[model samples]
Target: MTETPFKISIPDEKIALLRQKLELTTFPDELEDSGWEYGVPLSDVQRLVARWANGYDWKKHESQLNSELPQFTRDIDAEGHGTLSIHYVHKKSEIAAALPLLFIHGWPGSFLEARKLLPLVTKGSDNFPAFHFVAMSIPGYGFSQSPRTKGFDLAQYAEVANKLMLALGYTEYVTQGGDWGFPITCRIAQIYGGKHSKAWHTNMPIGEAPKSTTEPSLTEKEKAGLERTSWFHRFGGGYLRQQSTQPQTLGYSLSDSPAGLLAWIYEKLVNWSDSYQWEDDEVLTWLSIYWFSRGGPTASLRIYFEAGNHSLGAAFSVPEPRPTIPLGLSQFPKDILVYPKNWTREMGNVVFDADHESGGHFAAYERPEYLADDLRKMFGKGGPAFGVVSGHSGYA
Candidate 1:
């Protein structure tokens, strides 16, 4: 398979249609007392919709994306499962000089989420080191094509990620991830770490696998993580359940109305991220990606549905033996929850674990410098130090 070259440019018709949809949206009437219980406040949606219809500029975002990062497409051979095209953005750095680090994003996020790290990782920031960065959208999430089969779970994601490395000619590299990215990275290390696989790392690792019969013993932190997970199942799980069962019904509203899509995606940004202050430009930039592709609903829900059905037998059957590969973690206060270092020590060789005073789930987007510095110390030549970045380059 050969590399595919393309650029992002939204067509005039799509923009016009989006404007029409924004103008003619049949808004839902809300009760004064409902507040945020019925999802994003109707008032907030109206404000965002008005701005999206009149003020947001697709051209500006397109220009910024083209200028800041180089986007490319290549067909990654998914083991024996034929070939699939994947989209990726690599900072313009020397191949040999930069450290090859792949950043995988989580649910409700695309490759665009990882774009913030270009500056800090490529050019050492005040708190971090310079390393070559590569960010890819998960399959069915952004520009990447959806899996041909029904169940493209985390393990398959890891397998396909390895193929992506080979397709791009990466021998071994470090990885950084949170949420779904963390689990995917864990699977990568488990399968390919030490002798068999390449060295890898993850920040937010999952220690407690969902038990079917007996509840597993829980630490205080694990208990909190479980609560967060349960809370998600209670409140936010509707989206997951809908996606897993009948995604088509919801897709219609999201795919047809730009306002609907914006509300759906933007609400998550407001709640999940700690950097709402940094949201104005970033939010619109991400919306442009989904708006242009008309992939708002299909891609958004498909990943959740895929994860819901993913078989865990393979993941648990072969546990990861403690590998000597250096692992690092950054625990943030506002983050839903994270495992204790002792839990992670059972999986791989953990060298660094720091409890950050601030930041949240979207640390890379919200607190790039903090996360970057930790990454620099872990992967770069710089040893443990307060906010010192190493000068490294080249992403294989």
Candidate 2:
């Protein structure tokens, strides 16, 4: 597979056209005192849309991303999907013995989620292990080419990830991800573990628990988690229903109107976090990555439809084989579905688990330092997954 250096350079015409779309955009009416109870407030979208069309400097942010991120493109041939030109952020650590770690992102998010953790993970330290980080723009997201044919499911996603690592000469490596990333890497651990996949970790480790008759009682924390899960099923799960069954139909609105797309993703960005302050510029930057992505924002939504095994009206869950690799979880209180710890343990051979008082769905984005530290401890000396990658011990 041939790999090439990649850069983020949106053409002048595309930038101009985005402004045109934003200028001609229309917004929806809002209920008074809505304040996130009724989706994203109209005022937030308006202010962001106006700034997105005006003061927010795409070129400035574009250049900063280009400079800060070391990105590349490579043709990864999935067994049946043919050759796919994949885009990825590849930052090799200064430590020669650093372990290779793949970072994956889910819906409404791109490889940009790994930006903050990049420096922290790759930084050489006296006490902790460093990582050679590789975060791919999962096929249909960011600058990567989306799958041309239908039925490109989790297995295919795992295939692309494993091939990318093998192409980079990492015969064995570990992984970290959340959201759609959670399942994709779990499939990797199931398929490639014991040999190539070594060990894996997630900030969003969720699973179907054992039958009550065979399971232990729930803790107060676990009961609280169930409450959060119920809340999600009521308020935050509409997008899943639509995305799983008819992403193509919904894609039209997201594709045509900048306002529609902004409100759609902006809600999750706010609701998913535990009161994390989101600057308008930061919001726009996150939105811009989708808006300015190669496959368009709509393409990213297809994963929700493709990655699942559920039929319409059935519960939105994709059941997979239990992964046997060493699993480490950094559970956060505000994550979308805070599954009881027992459920996640039933899903894999869990070695380490840590819970935080703060943070949520976007753990890497919302709390980078904490996630980095958890990863360090998990892969550090005497940690459960230490030396899983053979010679690369992540030390000086």
Q: Using lDDT, give the best candidate's number.
A: 2
For every candidate in turn, the CA RMSD to the true structure comes to 4.8, 1.8
Q: TM-score, each model? A: 0.83, 0.96
lDDT of 2 at 332: 90
lDDT string for model 2 (9-114, tens) is 9999988999999999877678879787888888888999999999999999999999999999999997788888999999999899999999999877888899
Q: Which stretches of candidate 2 lie over 4 Å from their true place?
A: 214-217, 311-321
Give the worst 10-residue stretch by lDDT in candidate 1: 385-394
Clashes of each: 6, 0
Residues 277-381, candidate 1: write the lDDT tens digits.
744556767776776652454666665555536332233222546446566767775565555545545555666777676666788888887888777776544
Q: Candidate 1's error at 237, in angstroms? A: 3.7
Q: What lDDT score is found at residue 120 in candidate 2?
A: 97
Q: Distance (Å) between predicted and true CA of 323, model 2?
A: 2.0
